[model samples]
Target: MPQCREVPSRRRVPSTKITVPGPPADLVSRPRLLTVLDGASEAAMVFVGAPAGFGKTVLLAEWARSRDHEAVAWLSADAEDNDDRLFWSAVLEALGGCGRIPDGNPLRLLAVPDAPSTDLAFLGQVADALDELPEPVVLVLDGAQEITSPHPWQGLRALVRHQPAGLCLAVSSR
Candidate 1:
């Protein structure tokens, strides 16, 4: 039998200054860019795809800081996170960091090294929870190019496509 362990509850951590070197000077004043991107996200999906060193991450980070949203979850994707289970777990934890999980009960459908396929029903529960938010919730997936599998992408695409009205997604990839 699979060992059932509860996923750790995440808490809302105050945003810390992101220290990335050589951020463009002019990029800081572009409020219109953020406004447009935020508007775009409200209407449909917005993907920031660019090669490495294009300032995509910095731009999004700055924009997130400027927003008045209650919570913002940021996950820096690594190579190992390509695994669907690990990726989602990190995402869930990051969401927790943003105070998205209600009542401190985190539903765990995947365990490390188990590679169990994602359960859509559980995802539905998460989506429902996100929809109930009183204010907009922003989830930022940085370094998204690390995700190589189509399955996780498909799941993320579904989530983005069907995201609750109050939930917003911002993805950056090289």
Candidate 2:
């Protein structure tokens, strides 16, 4: 390894921080729920919508862990992730967790001032990048209800529409 001669300039970055939800320590395996959730694997989109304390998160967590062959990326949404750029920024980061999407940091690309602001065009690029993953990936966007604005969701919808063969989307929201 070589040491850097000079510290390169760092550009402005988005706060796309995310944490993949893990199954509870005392996870109660519900064969019934897992059976139903299994259907999501074949479909492009699966949404777990219900009020709080309905076990939606846990259910999704279990679904993600059930399979050994599939890659899983989790984005635990927060109040600040509502922005179009921030949302996709976090999504790309999560998807990169599967050891695909190469070694570059996605936020650096998204944060570039000249990048397109439209959700469709920008998110399309995101989808294209995700499609390059070595294996099919199941992306879990937890706490999706945190996003109040409708503008960013257009990007999410676009993702599902352009969803590649190796990608599946699972959203758990209140």
Best by TM-score: 2
lDDT of 2 by residue, 1-174 (tens): 998665222232243344445677987878887888786676888888999998888888777777652377777787876665566656765665554445663422443122223535566666676666566678888888998877557667776888776678888899
Off by over 4 Å in 1: 1-28, 99-117
Model 2: CA > 4 A from native: 1-17, 100-120
- lDDT of each prediction vs. the true structure? 0.64, 0.67
Whole-model alpha-carbon lDDT for candidate 1: 0.64
Q: Largest lDDT belongs to which candidate? A: 2
Question: Per-residue lDDT of 1-174 in model 1, one digit per residue for the tens?
Answer: 999977533332223311222346666556777887778767435678889987788878777677653366677776766667667667666666565445543332223233323556656666666776666667777888887887678777676667677577878898
Quote the positional error of residue 114 for candidate 2 in Å: 7.2
Show the lowest summed lDDT stretch of 10 residues, model 1.
12-21
The clash count for each model shown is: 0, 0
